[model samples]
Target: MESVRLNNGVEMPLVGLGTFKVRGYEAVYLVLDAALRHGYRSFDTASVYQNEADVGRVLKELLPKHGLSRTDVFITSKLAPRDHGAGAEAGCLRSLEALDCQYLDLYLVHWPGKQGCKSEDPGNPGWRQQSWEAMEGLYGSGRFRALGVSNYTEGHLRELLAKCRVKPAVLQVEYHPFLVQSQLLAFCRASGIHLQAYSSLGTGCLVAEPTVAGLAHSYGRTPAQVLLRWALQQGIGVIPKSTHPERIAQNAQLFDFHLAEEDMQALSGLHSDTRYCWDPRHVV
Candidate 1:
């Protein structure tokens, strides 16, 4: 239930349930219901995630069932690259409709690459800038409570910082022990932007690391908890996803324990420049 105050003065939860692959209602409903009942008030989703409606349904139905309301929970959706520029507004509007909310608590530019881009194709190098300009329009309209970017490298962030009239409130990226992204993290911190860590468990790879497992065992916790706690200790927000109810509940039990300074440094040494998600370095 801990929160980080965004630059726009909006509060985002330190931990959230990521609904990236919760495709169908059959699965999404049960998992989300369990999370809400377990006291989770934030959910991360996207336009391409293709299940915003399901997420909205759960929030609309479950929040009140759990004695909560729309304002009690935080919902985030993303802008698809194809929707950059002129389409950006409509893209987020569609998400708002699908999420059954008038406004999003946080809206993010999903990637630095442009529409129809599959790789470093080198086409439309200016698309991100255009999209950011369009998103700035949305941000100014107050339709989105906060705005940010995802998968942006330090270079992309630098470009954005130089051109943007409104500073991004957050920067989300694939961050974990294996890909510590030290420089990028420092940049965001120094710029007063919140860094939201995705794939904090390294897409399940961290759970199997002996060092992480040993730490988990010594602390009487799950490796997943250890990784999440590491992000928190570093003062980064994290969104760890799960399909199982038990795992979802377990991910939320991070407020009680604190990692020692030595253990924190040990985890820091696990960085190997690995990436489980797509790299944005070539977007330019």
Candidate 2:
């Protein structure tokens, strides 16, 4: 697997297994098993995803089964919105316990806004900043190899950057040919913050797009591969998930091909500001 170095110098795989709606321990076990079998070294999950323990259990057992160890795998989990305020450190501890790991490879603020703040208004003073402040301490403690944020818009990132004691190492956001956020991507790149793409396959809706289909046809690859490759080609990390062993194996085959410049331009033109998942821009 190809790797990108985080700002802190930790090596992260370019491709990762994202568990969003993937449910149940058995299902997670199956998918994770398949992923490891196919050379996947990174996995993404969250407390809100409800399968952290399941993923943790499988990792504890399966890595050794596959002749790998915790040091060999890169695991990422996020903080829940509800845990945004005073509960941030406790939340990190919960995730640490749930994942059964001494530390996390990467931990992120799941959203730009806070929840259950004392003011009950994220826009109110001291609410939104609370989350990042708490996370900054945890990051300083060395419990997380790197710290980042998810679903953050340019404004959100800008605010965080202005006050942050430790600069965010990454910004994981939803991106695909049809709904790419190019400006946000450029900001992160220019700032030396690694950008990661979630929902890269458009939550499985981009497969039917004529542009993507044409690209897939020309590349002789699946639509999914086209989307994943597009994100990778732009130097953005991607976490595309699948449960089927064949699909899991297929997703890992991204290292062998390249997308041409004009083809990339065509895909870039498909961006419509169409978001397929949760939008955090209005959270304040």
Candidate 3:
């Protein structure tokens, strides 16, 4: 798999397995096993996902069976907003315990919470600044190899940068053919921050879109592949999730093809500024 080097010189996989809305120990084990067998070493999970223990259990058991160690895989987790303030550090520690790992390869603020919730709670408090301070402390402790935020707008990032001594190493967001987020991408590149794209397949909402269908047919690939390649060409890390073994394998087979400059522009032109995740306004 290809890799992106962070400002601190840590190497992160350009493609990873995203575990969102995936539940139950049995289900997580099935997907995690498939992902690992399909050459996926980077795994993204969060406390809110409620599958950390299952994921950790599977990894601990499977790695030994495959002759792999914790150091051989890149594990990432997020700090939930409800755990902000004095509870933030403790929350991360709990996640570490659940994941059965000594340190995380990456840790992110799940969202810039208003009070502490990312959805429809405008009155949530002490989320942004408090969570950031906790993350900074985690970074200083050397427990997390890298620190970042997910679903943060430019304004959110600006606020953190102004107060954070250790600038975020990454900014994860919903990005795809329909929402390119060009300005944020440019700003992140300029600031030496790695930008990761979630919902890179347009959240499966593009399956019926004529534009994506046409492009997929032309390339003789799935729509998912087309969208993922587009994001990679833009130098953004992508974590596309799938439970089907074949689809999981297909998502990783992107390095063999290159999208032409014209095709790239065509995909970019399809952008409608669409977002498939939670609203940042409610969070921040």
Tell me each candidate's TM-score: 0.96, 0.96, 0.94
lDDT per residue as tens, model 1, 1-284: 79999987999999999988889887888988989988788999999899999989877878878888899998888998788766767787888899889888888999887767665765544677777787777778877888899998888888889999889999999999899988998999999899999999988989989999999999999999999999998889999999999999999999999999999989989989999988878776
Give the residue spans of candidate 3 off by over 4 A: 114-126, 282-284
Looking at model 2, residue 128 earns an lDDT score of 48
**Residue 190 shift from truth in candidate 3, angstroms:** 0.6
Cα-based lDDT at residue 104, candidate 3: 94
lDDT of 2 by residue, 1-284 (tens): 99999998999999999998888888998999999999999999999999899999988989989999899999999999888767788888899999998899999988766665432364523544777787777778888989998988888788888988888998999988877787888899889999999989888899989999988998899999888999999999999988888988988899899999999999999989898998776665
lDDT of 1 at 159: 86
Which 10-residue window in model 1 sums to the lowest lDDT?
117-126
Candidate 1 collision pairs: none
Give Cα distance to truth, residue 71, candidate 2, Å: 0.4
lDDT by residue for model 3 over 1-284, one digit each (tens)?
99999988889999999999888888888888888888898999999999999889999988877678898889999987678666787888989999988889999988776333445454334556777787777788888889898988887888888888878998999988788899999999989999999998777998667877888898898888888999999999999899888899999989988888998998899898788886685444
Give per-residue lDDT, candidate 2, residue 196.
95
Off by over 4 Å in 2: 116-125
- Candidate of highest lDDT: 1
Over 4 Å off in model 1, which ranges? 118-125
